[model samples]
Target chain A: MVGSALNQIEIRRLVKAFGNRAVLKGVDLTVAEGEFLTLVGPNGAGKTTLMNVISTLTKPTGGLVRVAGYDLADGAVAVRRQIGLVSHKTLLYDDLSAEQNLRFYARMYDVPNVEARIETVLRRVGLWGRQRDPVRTYSRGMQQRLAIARAMLHDPPILLLDEPDTGLDQHAAAMLTDLLHEVGATRRTVLMTTHNLDRGLELGDRVAILAGGRIAYQAAKSELDAEQFREVYYQYVKQRV
Target chain B: MPLIMPYLRKVFAIVAKDVVAELRTREMLSSMFVFSLLVILIFNFAFDLRAENQKTLAPGVLWVAIAFAGMLGLSRSFIMEKDRGSIEGLLLTPVDRSAIYLGKMLGNVLFISVVEIVILPIFVVLFNLSARDLPLLVGVMILGTIGFAGVGTLFSAMVIHTRAREVLLPILLFPVVIPVMLSAVKLTAAILDRLPFADVQNWFSLLVAFDAIFMALSFILFDYVMEE
Candidate 1:
């Protein structure tokens, strides 16, 4: 039961609203560990808001959210400790060196052997040489790498990426995909939001389209062809609009 | 200790990081220091009163300068965090939201303390009077700074999303922080004139009350201000 519980994130009838405008309406989802789940949606389809809810950054207006076996509403702190997020924003201090930023976060996370861990992660992200420089001096690609480094520093069992490829070039995006695969191989569950359909399908074990604040379509990559997936997505979005 | 220890550590780490960054850049403190001195200089010239009259007016002038200068420091406190998206990074961590608020408020307190330390002596030299009640003056400064920074940090988080952040901070803050300013001025006047503590006990209580109220309010409201 513990093993099974360790491998899943469950959301049921989740609803979130800002004022009277509802963003997520009775959305439901389940993701297994080691599964690369991609949430693809058009703008304003509540993808980010749903992600925020799952990450415990935003509370839901209604419904159940459980991540890594912890209930979001009741065990939010525990749930948060098990999840890591990378978003379009770098979320690093420009004045601090990359290493300092990582060390700061590592201390915040209370990760043991912080110095060794920061060195290893910076090297993994190909940022070791520039780790001493302030983040403001870093290129967009470098900052994204540092952001990824920060997210993975605590070694959470789950990862959430919100358009992680937004500012990256093909080379960087390819590296990110490889990193995602490596993380997934370690039996960590991954939920990502992306606009890049090809990249999403290529990396995801299961691809989901969020529309009208709900999951309009979801299936394993092997179950659907690219053309069919695109057609389904287009129709779903069109009908919702 | 329980898990809150880690969150507290994170808060202190953030505070330390801000201090180190400010030390290197000297951006926030220098601006606050220079602006405060300039305000005092302006007050000296504007009043142009004799020493007998200056004693009575000094407390009001000193606090006004501190208030305006403190606002400058408070507004800049979160600019780097918002600019580099560090707040989002912070939210991603497993720490409690109130920890972030406390850390940022403490950082503001330290910065304001630095400004006050420098300005206090300068104030004495300019006004040609000794601050005989230094301990009470410091106490009032701490209470006033805490109350101001607590609310200022929260408002800064709110206005970072707005178009006119600089203008919005004072507009939103000044009305709300009236109690803090009133208590500070009253306490300062009492101390400056060497009044008995019993006579000024109400002012001290008011200052403590304002600090507690605003601190709690800011801690609770911070999560809302941090939301995307």
Candidate 2:
């Protein structure tokens, strides 16, 4: 199983420390190819830090991280080519239209057939009609949707999302949920972190909770429903604190 | 040629995006143009001019204007990216990190050159200078701006995340480029005085050397600085 086709991400004893304070302490986790793993963690649990590490946006203080069969330290550019990250920031230029923004990233990633891909992704996000409008004019939901389209431009097989559904209303949240499910169904490996436990359990094939910079509790999602997972999460975090 | 073409395209892509953004606002260029005129106007009024001494002081005045105005453009190059939250997105691209440095450096150089081009005629009119060596003066100005833009681009990236970056960037940048500034001022003086090219060759070579050294160091060290 170590080098099997199913293995997309493997982390062993990951540690990230800023000065004397350690934020992620010897965290170990693995996500199989085409599996959707949702990580639920309390505030300050280092979830974002771990996502940054996997995307190679942040380097680790120590330990091993390998994504898409390449080591993190020596293979950053290679790793970047294989993953797309959606963080809190939309990462879109406010002045550039959605089409221009996608075109810019498509060129950066050297994505072939750039125009067609931009159109397809814009259509998928339900923003094709407004492609020429500056992203500044976009509503929060529309901008978030454009952000997702930007990530999908390069079409990397590994997707890392950090709190992607943080600020959406119910209608937009439902749209995002549908999009996430479609993305997961397309045989891509996904690792997501969220505070919404109900959505996390519903979407994840496996659920992992991080506390005190470590994996506090992890199990198959089918083994615990939303109510049981809440009890487990609170009790586990309370004991650790 | 084919192998290097893609990298060149990426470099130009970044510059194009920046150019498009700047055109939409015209903020950086307008500020630099206005500030350049203000500096020369202030110096023109403040100084008691002897026509003979004006030739002597012309180089210092020209470079001082260019350097100060160019610093504003350079700081805005990366600061705008950081402010709009696009720097991280730029960083995650698959190309070498040095490509981003080169692209920003090129954008900074382009903005400086544009402002300097506009300011040159104003400079000549205000200082009452003749056109004996205008071509040579433009040549030296280009060289001087390259070194200025290179060092400024490096430091602007370093200070992008810091507080009061407006105050911090100049403080960090001014001391480091003193050599380039001195060489540039000397070259400008030599050209304005219409001294034989041989007299200023040393300064010209030194400016080129400074530019080359700074560009190499900035490109080599930027990858390490960008990685967090």
Candidate 3:
């Protein structure tokens, strides 16, 4: 039983509500190590709420959450240390230079060799060239890249990205896809939420269709075609509405 | 040893960063200096004090200028952080939330101290008074600024997210910080008049007690304010 409980992320009976409206109603899911799990849902399906709960950014009304072998309720701080996040929000200081932003986070995380780590991450994210420029001077794509650099600075084992592709152009999106692929290849667990079905299908190891605050359908990339996935997705949305 | 060192270092780092930024921009200090000078100038005309009248009112006018200018500086402390999204960045880091609070408080204290340092000489020149009890006056300034910053940091964090942030900071802050201001003004007056320390022990005790209580409360409640 102990060996069987190897999932990197696990949720059981996760329920969240605001006022009388239940956002996530008795939802359950598990993500294994190195799994690239993409959650695709309509606007009000509670994907972000679930992500927030898992990240310990929001307290759930009810449920169990475990990340990186630590129970969220019991070891929230440890779990937070293990999970890195990239949200639609850039979360970068606009006035600080790119280098300062990374250095600030490195100090916060108490990462060793902070200067070297900052240099390496900046180079990896293709921001080393513009490390001295204030983030306010960065373009949207550049800012997102720096955000990714911040998230990856600590080398956390799990990454939760909420629409990491929000404002990127085609070239940037492709680059992001490549970066995600690189991250996945290194065996880090990733849980991402997006409305982009085609990219989600192409990048995800497993695509999950969330509707009515529950996962209506989940399939490996090889198991579902685009048309089948779309039909089922739309059907669930219509039924829920 | 008490896990306070790292937080203190963090606070110093933030203060240093803010000092450097301000030195480069002169945004906060210039505004505070100009505004404080204007307040003192207005007081000069309003009170219409001759040489003898200046001595009696100088302490009150000096502190009033410092307090108002300090509030202006504290109010803007988190505005830049929030506007630049730096607060969220700090929160997402694995550092203790209390460290962030202390760090911000220290930054505010440093800024207010700088303003006070500049204003002290100006006050002396304006009122034509000798800088008596230099060490004690400096001590009072530090304690007073700490108390003001402790309460101001907490209120600023609360109002940073509110719709009426600019208006809300003073509204929530003034009442809570009144005890510190009262104690500070008394102590400053006592020191300026060359009064005995024992005579002002009451104000000193009040200052120490207010500083301890508010600092502890601010440390504990900071986590809730920073929660996403």
The top-ranked prediction according to lDDT is: 2
Error of 3 at A114 (Å): 2.1
Question: What does the lDDT read for residue B17 in candidate 2?
Answer: 92
Chain A TM-score, prediction 1: 0.95
Native-to-model Cα distance after best TM-score fit, residue B156 in candidate 3, in Å = 1.4
The sequence of per-residue lDDT tens digits that candidate 3 reaches over residues A112-205 is: 8988999998898888889998888998888988888889999999999899999899988888888888887887899999999987888789
Rank ordering of all candidates by lDDT, starting from the highest: 2, 1, 3
TM-score of each: 0.94, 0.97, 0.93
- Evaluated on chain B only, what are the TM-scores of all the candidate structures, in order? 0.94, 0.96, 0.93
Give the DockQ-based CAPRI class for model 2. medium
Task: Compose the digit string of candidate 2's lDDT tens values, residues B112-209.
Answer: 99998898998988888887668988988888889999999999999887888878999999899898899988988877777888987888888999
Rank order (by TM-score, best first):
2, 1, 3
- lDDT by residue (tens digit), candidate 3, B154-202: 8888888778898988888888888888888889888777888899899
DockQ (0 to 1) for model 3 = 0.46
Give the local distance difference test score of model 1. 0.86
Report the Cα lDDT for residue B8, model 2.
84
lDDT, candidate 1, B101-188, per-residue tens: 8898999989989999999988888887676777778888988999888888888888887778888989999999898898888888
Q: Kindly report the interface RMSD of candidate 2, rounded to 1 decimal.
A: 1.0
Error of 1 at B5 (Å): 4.2
